[model samples]
Target: MTEAPGQITAETPPRLVVLISGRGSNLGALIEACEQGQIPARIVGVVSNRPDAGGLGFAEQHGIPSQVLNHRDYPTREAFDADLATAIEGYAPDWVILAGFMRILTPGFVDRFTGRMLNIHPSLLPKYRGLDTHARALADGETEHGASVHFVTPELDGGPVIMQARVPIVSDDTADTLAARVQRAEHRLYPEVVRRVCSGEIQWSGRILQADGTPLGAPLQLDEDTHNASPPQPAG
Candidate 1:
């Protein structure tokens, strides 16, 4: 199988097509990162399933191409995904990023960009896989909870993790408070993972994740402390 478009050489920055459904603070972060030359990639376009998504406005303000294909207008999930894929492929992105894209894509749609797409979830994988993650974490009396960035797979939140950001669940933290902290961490974590992916330092080999050609066996962790530290040395 051919490598995903995410696999990039050192010479050119990766091209990105970011998808969003809401306000898209993460999308804003990406746009800032690209502008500041922090992440070695370019967001060529932003697509939203909601016509009124705020991110589209952010994209326009920054002069990035934006599009809306309301999922509600489509007859079925597969049809929506087909058109969505076509719209995204038009940009010829090296990666398709789901930055708070709330839709659950069809299997065929996911397969079309299997190894090239990515998503960031509000909770650690194998844990609060769906919504209300902050509430769930608080209710569970979890001492620590955070966000995860992973490859997009047909199984919801089941793809091999690329990186994670962990934060302490304080004694009196409510869902909103906890979510705020996690979002800050996410703004840091997601770009770093993208940097690694763009630098050819880490990659998905269809089934497993590898750093420098060696299997990771599990996703790399990026806690609050290490979030600012140098990137982890690849395991031998």
Candidate 2:
């Protein structure tokens, strides 16, 4: 069962299971953070949907156990998810981190973990919920674009956002350029959020909150240039 908000701490550091697709930069960030004692947790396992994902090599290099559950091999989404859940459960993880997992999980799979899972998206949430977020923002000529970390709900990227790091859209920025900058922000932003969650500084009790047991009025913020996180802001 998912632990209640504030249940995780340094005494009982969360056993983190990270899911990744593609490059898995966020996974690498988490790994570094764990090794450096930045987060009160250890990554127990890493899962990837594609066997060739570069993240798999990272996992192996770190001596962390990893599995690849090719979604195409499964007959249905639910079947794939059921097996995925089993693979994750084997590690007895206290938290599931979707570093770059690309699949749209089934509701059953999503609900299984409930409050114990998190994901980082490319764009600040409630604005860009789906793919190509950088391109979309550029198309709209938005002045600001960034990344967000949110609880994993079945509604794709429509989950409750917990934190964000905003970077200004430069006049000459291409989608690739913007993505590169945002990813750097993510390396900073994702690890810090995980540190907070594992340290019991942030938790989800129906809604996200601080260790003081107050609601997080607004998503946590990070400085664009320094990537330094600001204190928790009041909810509007």
Candidate 3:
């Protein structure tokens, strides 16, 4: 199983170390894709700040190594992130992904990884850059909402945008419903973004991101109903 001679290889598919803190549905998506020979990366390990995170179970079930560094066990955020970096670095991952990981990273740690780390946020980004993005978008009367894949920087959700898939803000959409829809897009978008990252199809240089052979352009505008004219039901 040899991958193309790019950023990743079959023997080493840009070893990924995922960080998760909850249901890990996105983590599960990544694992499933890897098992099915979809993405050009492999999960070297999974890390969580909470031991009870259900994603840890998913990783263990798939035989992917996992670790927990309880934030409560540390005295300060910097100390905890330092330990987290140490543990994740132990696996020598080419990239680190935040899959539902709910911790604000320190500039020092983010600087360490720079363009090698990424995160998935459930909003169009630059629109809603912080927590509760789903509810925030709806409350703001946004016409469309979606997920963003971006380089993880020191600023909260302020990294260079990579890819996004839009979902309509229907008349009856609620935070929960919109969130579910966004998650579905996330499952597809995150893996594609990871593949691009690992294959070198996408590159982050300075403050811009490019795909294939050229610049991807500024904040992408997306169609609310991409596959179907009618709004798709939220994932149950």
Candidate 4:
């Protein structure tokens, strides 16, 4: 039998196996970060549940190996996650990055990679945990919105946040507009978080700790708004 392409050997930089379910914009950011040495690790493989996922193309474009494991083929969610775990572990990844992987993972799967999986969510988290985050934020008349990088836990987006990039809400923003702006922030925020983890500036020792050995306080912020979508909204 042919071995998978992502098997980690004794000698290699930290390996990452990224999971995506849609356009690979964030995956592209990660790939760029790895290739440019901004991140000291490498993405050994990209896996998606949807074969049609556009991110798969990004993986192919970069010569990185890609695989698709359709959930529809499995009778139960647990079974799918089981096989998914097998495939991911096959790579021997140091980290599993969920860029836009849209699945509620089983507790068993979460336990298998505890402290080693990271996910980037669209909403600030503790704000909008599931779908329709952009529209919901606009409906609530919120002034700020952005993305968050967090450790993946069983509670669906309830995991502890590690960092966030806050963007000023543009007055003219529709859901699409807001989502686009936030995604740009994600491109920046996610890579920085991974870079920190890979470089040991951030470590997970039963809990997240900073380079100074201080517990990560309030999730590091990239909150400085270098660009205003509209004239900035006044602080509430």
Candidate 5:
């Protein structure tokens, strides 16, 4: 495990195991923040479900160890998650972060970790909880779209949210355009959420999420855009 870039003079930093499956823009943000003394956590290792994921390169560039456990290699999702659990446990991570891991984990695996896991969903969550969130939101003519960082549970995106950043869906926005904006929010929100979790400022109870014991903002329900300063709306 490499030392996290930031110094934690006041508290102990959590060791992190990050999972990724794609371009890894959010992972890059976290690595940069940790390296720059911004986030208060050590990235113990990076794991991916795809060997070709670009996040592996990002981790390698920063001198962090990276591993891949391809889901296709396993006989079932449960088996793959089991291997993943074993690999992550070997590193003894304090936090398991799903940066962009595209797989849905089993309840057994999620239960094993308890409140130790975190994930960022592209939508505000409790809304468009599954895949293709941006496109789905656009197709639904939603005015606002954003990113959320929440505790991971067996029920997908059902855990309480820690933090979020909102981006209005402009009328001209395509799924690609909207996704770029949401991704930027995800990049910013994930690092900040990680910092808080590592610093003991936030708590994940597995059932409810909170910041410093008080639930942060409103609940992360999707239909209302609870975290937005100015929610996006359908074009008049």
Candidate 6:
């Protein structure tokens, strides 16, 4: 099993290596959190599978090191993962964060980070595990939908969820509308989860997840009103 990131302290914040494939809105949130001292962590670098990912520019603007290892250049997933892992390990990251990173990682890559990796899924998870979550949720007439932040495991999005924020499904809500709300929730939820992880308030021992040393059989749900506020802060 991979070791957890070193406990964060005021003098030594946790180091994060974020991976992105697109706009990286979640990445933006994390950057803001670190800058504002909301989380005791530093985003050491940002890596993207696409050379033209917009997140790379955002990283550069903030003076954060950024790298691109285009997936198309590699012949196989394992090959790409090998190179990717090498690039990430070079930074000596305390945590590997997938913020909209659009690649299905190989087991080798997943195992390298194991307990020290995290991802934000746009859905409530264990519901629409794959994609098109907004459309699916709306079509099913679900009354509630939102986002989840979970540990990264080899079973795709099957990892245990740490925290979730729910949005009420309104009448005549389209996929696009619902997705916008969910994205807003994600920006708030993901950073709080990262904060908790870095503070050692939440952790995974083997496959079980715990918060404040108490086992959490299910993901902790956040009150949408309070948790979805601007510039998320640590939950008490």
Cα deviation at 166, candidate 2, in Å, is: 0.7
Error of 3 at 182 (Å): 0.9
Q: For residues 121-172, could you state the per-residue lDDT of candidate 5 as single tens digits?
A: 9987778999999999999999998888888878888887666677899989
Candidate 1, 72-140: lDDT as tens digits: 999999899999999998988888899999999999999998888989999988799989999999999
lDDT of 4 by residue, 1-236 (tens): 22222223335667889999999899999999999987778898999999899999999999998899999999999999999999998877888999999888999999988877999999887999899999999999999998988888888998877778888888899999999999999988988888877665666654554433556556677745542122212222
Better of 1 and 6 by TM-score: 6
Q: What is the C-alpha lDDT of each candidate?
A: 0.86, 0.87, 0.82, 0.83, 0.79, 0.87
**Tens digits of per-residue lDDT for model 2 on 1-236?**
54443467545667899999899899999999999988778899999999889999889999999999999899999999999999999988888999989999999999998888999999988888889999999999999999999888889898777789998899999999999999999999999888877767777865555534557777888876665667776665
Q: Each model's TM-score?
A: 0.93, 0.94, 0.89, 0.89, 0.86, 0.93
Off by over 4 Å in 6: 1-6, 228-236
Per the 3 Å backbone cut-off, how many clashing residue pairs does candidate 3 have?
0
Q: What local lDDT score does residue 29 receive in model 1, on the 0 to 100 scale?
A: 91
- For model 6, the local distance difference test gives 0.87
lDDT by residue (1-236, candidate 6, tens digit) is 22347486666778999999999889999999989988889999999999889998889989999899999999999999999999999888899999999999998889888999999998888989988999999989899999989998999898988888889999989999999999998888989889989989888876568887777867888776777323323333
Highest-scoring model, lDDT: 6
Query: After best superposition, candidate 4 residue 40: deviation in angstroms?
Result: 0.4
Q: Cα lDDT for residue 205, model 2?
A: 69
- Of the two candidates 1 and 3, the one with more favorable lDDT, higher being better, is 1
Cα lDDT tens digits, model 3, 34-147, are 778778778989999998999999998999999999999999999999999999889888888999999999999999988889899988878888888989998999999999
